[model samples]
Target chain A: MAVASAVAYRPPRLARKRTRQAVLVWCFLAPSLAIFLLYRIIPLLWNVVLSFADWAPLRTIRWAGLDQYEEMLHDDVFWEALWNTLLFIASAPVGIVIALGLALLVSSEIRGRDVYRTIIFISYPLMTVAVAIIWRWLFDERVGLINYVARSLHLVDRPIQFLNSFVWALPSVIVANIWQMLGFYMIILLTGLQNIPPNLYEAAAIDGANARRRFWRITLPLLKPSLFLCIVIGMLNSFTSFDLVYVMTGGGPGRATELLVTYIYKLGFSQTRFDYAAAVTIVFFALLVAIAWMANRLSGGNAGAVETD
Target chain B: MHRYPRWPIHLVLVGVSFLMLIPFYWVLKTSVTGENIFAYPPSILPKSPHPFYYVDVWYYIPFARYFANSVAVSMIAVIANVVLNAMAGYALTRDFPAKAFVLLLFLSCMMVPFQATIIPAYLITGRLGLLDSYLGLALPQFSTIVCIFVFKASFDAVPRSLIDAARIDGLAEWRIVWKVMLPLAKGAIATNVILAFIWSWNNFLWPLIVTRSADMQTLPLGLARFLSYQEDTTGALYAFCIMVLAPGILLFLLAQKEFIRGLTSGATKG
Candidate 1:
């Protein structure tokens, strides 16, 4: 009887202890989970639902069923914004290339490399809005430094209206974007460069691999994960660059710089087109997920930079 | 190892660094010298720099109020991030049911960039009646996935024997995290604090959407409004920009090692 009683006691107590741990782990997780659910997951699902309904603040939401997407089909601004966003994504490789060069330079044994890295990275951590302001002034048409230098050096006939011109506005914003992002890319690539086994280069040297051949064969392939990471970040920047475009040009001078994010903001807050904005949001989210998926595939099914598991 | 001349590398890096730094120099030059857009031949150096423009910025707007608002919001975010992320990260280190699912959830949440969620985030914040308030401004950024991972990496590096010893001493799970774990996770905590502070400080859009009242505006919004209001007429706008950027730059300069580590933590681990 005593043995049976002890056995009975042991199972329940063990089960209770397991239950207690599960509860404790969950309790620890509760706050962060609550915040993410409220801010990220719920809002994401709600955005999807809102896209399908004609709703505004304080108005009853009514199901519209593909109407918003249909409107998006004909909306020229939507197309332009989408095109501009893709252009931004396309420009990512340009920044990455330059950053790669900078990374290689700094990663080598050189004087004042840390200082150079610090100076290059300083611009990145500045407020984007403030950076926009600074760039706007730099690109100012009349007394702008760029114009002054151009006029002095005979680079152009007149001060180019960088932010005001349709052709120049998008590229100008892209330049600013690249400038701010270059440091971050360099750092990531620098880390990648540092991780490469020196013995691989040594092996290549013994094989009579020239510097260029060694770089092409050894350095580039090993840097795939980091390169892919930069590409992903660059893609993500298109959506996240709202503040830069918003403050610099406000998607103005004929929507030349109108990114999807700025367009969505304008539609929802400025124009009170919540339903349509939600639709754009869904499309934007889908684009990002697609990019991530493609990036994952491109990295041979393990996007190490973004690996979840 | 092959040796190469260093001058060319220095030359190129110096030129690139100059390009990277020119904008900041230009802004600082304008702010102090009160150079307007019409200042021709754009002086290579400041003719006369002064602090009056900063004073003008201070007087032109409610700079103090905006500064206070920014500090409060960043404080809430940094403190909450360090505490909550430490707990969540500690929880992640332990074996538990659905651990994989939780991590996947966190990863997916990261992909849902905050910019894409603005419309509904605003609506939800409105529902919670937190708009135009400090909590509303800081709520969305209270916990970030990367910082959580930073804490996890730091905690994972802590020796398992120490935790076991703590457990043997009859320490509770929370107590283990507090007494045994946190003492060793100072680097992660610093990373979290700096990253959280910078993100909260530099945030523009959320505050733009959430804050309706002028008084509720943060430094970024204030600087934006000031830009529009003044339109670069005086040096005050640039002064405001400098003032707005100073804290972030200062913090970055002070703790750049940790800042860079926090950013590159996940990338390097992979």
Candidate 2:
């Protein structure tokens, strides 16, 4: 209806051209629309339907009608996973601060800045599985370098047991996650930093402003849109994080690290409770929607001012 | 002499960069180190740099096959996405009925997580007899929402006058998009191509689920198999890590410009 109303008031000569354009547009959109609907959208709707029924892959789906949702409301594990997901999101500010700090440091007229940027960004392309695998080895109890170094420096009495311990496992994973994500965000934030006209800083210096004051007043406001974008994407990505947890801890140590997405996987695949998993997934989807909507409302969803890759 | 002496800043930047590069260094060091990786005071540099670990990984594991499979799958998937998304992006942005409906459809696809469809996708693949095959891997990614979004943004950037002029000529719609639009959008196309390739190459979960046989595994799945070997051969594990990382890292190095450009393209809108 919006598009129809949009095209309704065109001139006659433009009308024929517009019709042709319309046909061309559909021809372009068909394949992608088909695939997205089939693989992504339909499955989402199917998951919603499955949530209301006792759907299992091997057995006939029986309508449960909000029983799963009700169960989720009472489940302690559900609450735990929710809190962990929030914890993970909370962890992202560390990465943001690190990224912004690096971007600020490297964005200056430092010699070899390009080399530094390239080396830092190099890890972004390495497969996440390889990173997780190697990091796991590094976090190993007996042989891991982190514990060895810490012990050597008299930082701890014994090995830290990074992954095995319930208390340390999530934080350890969070550190690795931040490491992997920092380069990408730094590069992103650097671009925004560089976009600020150099003249502004020069003028500020001429007016006797200190570096700290210049950064706080001039740089921070100009970089708000990018910072806001980074926050939203970082939060969303952390909330739905699965690969790191799957590869590192497998949500082990008695489900201490089980995120909502990971929980959805366990319930559906491991427990064979598809309907319940579907309900969980539906709620998870709602959470994502709510978060994105909240961010948009906060920022006014101005694609021109703030967007994320 | 001290006009531009920000040496301390440089020192700090280099320090952080070294911190960034440590993991890659460890990967290289561990792959070549002798059988003492688990020893205390880990070797800063391997005393005896053994190159045979690479050869051993190829011989002892099906890594060669996995590498080839990854290359094939990533290439096919990237190509399919590039072509399909270019068309879809052009249509949705430039012309067509129900334009708002189409755009909303694309946007909503981004909202749906793949975890919801993993089982159904497996069932579909099974029904289509696509299990443990290349099609099962490549087909799903071809309809990627991210690529469509990228291409649509690029197509939107194309000047309206040029498109109108082409239409004024005797050019067909397909010819206009193919000849006129695509040729003008090489930078964006290259950006999407590299991104799509990197993503497809790194994908582990789908391949792990779909492929049943060892021979059909991609590099990620192959590395997982290598890690699960229980051999405790640290050198071999490092060698496997290097193999898994080498291609993606090398590609990233080569396409660093595009990688950064593509990543920041959306970011700067803020």
Candidate 3:
């Protein structure tokens, strides 16, 4: 009805050219709209439907109602994964703080800012599979760099199994994730920092404010938007924690690092329980929607913070 | 010479940079040396550089096949992202009824994570008989909301006079977009291409679900299989890592400034 109202009052004389322009517009929009429908919107709706149905390899699909959600409630692994997913969300600020620190440093004129920026930002572009592979090697028990340094410094009698230990698995992956992501946050934050009006800082300095005072009084308040953007983007990124968790531990050492997406993969593909996984997907989808709604509020209705590559 | 003390800042930045480059240096060093990678007191430097592992990785596994698949998929994704996204973006820029609705649709699509969409995406791809096909792997990635916005932002930047002048000269709407606008938006296009390449090449989950045959696996999937199957061999894994990671890194390096500008413009303009 709203759309009908929008195009209803096309004046008859200008209708032809308007129609021409409209045809051209849709001609351009066809491919993307089709993709959006087929790949995104349809799949999302299908996920919602599939959650309420059960699938068996040889047997026919049957309506399971909330059976899958019931199973999810009883599953201990599901609870653990839920906990780990929250942990992953909580881990966002670790990377953000580090990135803010690095961004603050690099945004200033110390020296070799370009080199620092390039090297720091390099990891963001590398494949997580490769980075995870390297980190695996680094965290190896025997001659891995972490072990080597620990042993040399007499910090331990043995190399800690960083990826293998349940206690350390999430933290280890979190460290690698932060290492990979800090640069991206730094770059984003650096841009935000550069956008701050210099006069604000200049006036603060001229009024006998110290460097610390200037940062708190001038920089911190202004930098809140960028910081908030990083927080939300980082949390959104934490949702798709499949690749690193897969390569690093395979969500392993007994499902210690199992993120929800990884658990969904395990259920759907590994166990052939698509219905249960679909339920998990729906639940998480709702959670993310709530988070995205909050992100909209945080960004003051500019929700582009959630729309990243 | 700076206002703040330079020494402390330089020291901190250099230290952090080194920490950041640790994984790259370790991978490169291990792949080259072929020495006891797990030996205690890990060699800080390569004693004997052995580049043969790169060759060994190819013969041991079908690295060439995976590399080729990745290349083809990434290239197709890049081209499609550039062209189709630019079209949708251009269309959104026009003063048409329901423009806000269409734009909202795109943004909402962006919010839906692929984890939710993967099950049905697999089903649809299976229905199309595209499972294990390159087109199937590359198809869903063709258009992203980010790319559309990039192009729209670029199109918005093209001065109204330039587009109007092209209109006066009898160019069609798309021709105006193509001839008058796209050239000016090469920075956006380049960023889109690089980002699309990285996303496609690094994508492991969808391919893992879609691909059954070993030969059809992309490089990331292949490396993962190697890590799981040949868990003892570190050198070949490093070699594969170096090979798979280099292209994306080099592409980013080549287009660093444009990429940063494109990113920040989307960021600030938002």
On lDDT, the leading prediction is 1
Model 2 C-alpha RMSD vs. true structure (Å) is 4.7
**Candidate whose DockQ is highest:** 1
Q: List the pairs of residues colliding in candidate 3.
A: B32-B50
Candidate 3 docking DockQ? 0.66
Q: Number of clashing residue pairs in every model?
A: 0, 5, 1
Model 1: chain B TM-score relative to the native chain B = 0.97
Looking at every candidate separately, what fraction of the true A–B Cα contacts under 8 Å does it contain?
Answer: 0.81, 0.65, 0.73
Compute each candidate's TM-score over C-alphas: 0.97, 0.91, 0.95
Tens digits of per-residue lDDT, candidate 3, B1-270, equal 145568888998889988988878887988987575656576888987978988889888988888888888888888888889899888878888888788778878878887778878888898899999889999999899878888887788789998889999999876887788989988888888877877898898999999999878999899899988878465877888888888888888998887776656545754
Tens digit of per-residue lDDT, candidate 2, span B36-128 = 565877767677787988888877787779889999999889999889978876765654456767667666676666765775666667777
Against the native complex, each candidate's DockQ, computed on alpha carbons, is 0.77, 0.57, 0.66
lDDT of each: 0.90, 0.79, 0.84
Worst 10 residues of 3 chain A by lDDT: A300-309
The regions of model 2 sitting more than 4 angstroms off are A1-18, A206-208, A300-309, B1-5, B123-129, B231-233
Per residue, candidate 1 scores C-alpha lDDT tens digits across A1-309 of 999988777757778889888898898899999999999999899999999999988799899999999999999999999999999999999999999999999998887899999998898888999999999998899888788888899999888999999999999999999999999999989988999999999999998999899889989999988888888888898667999999999998899999999999999999988899989999999999998898888789665554443
Of all native A–B interface contacts, model 2 reproduces a fraction of 0.65
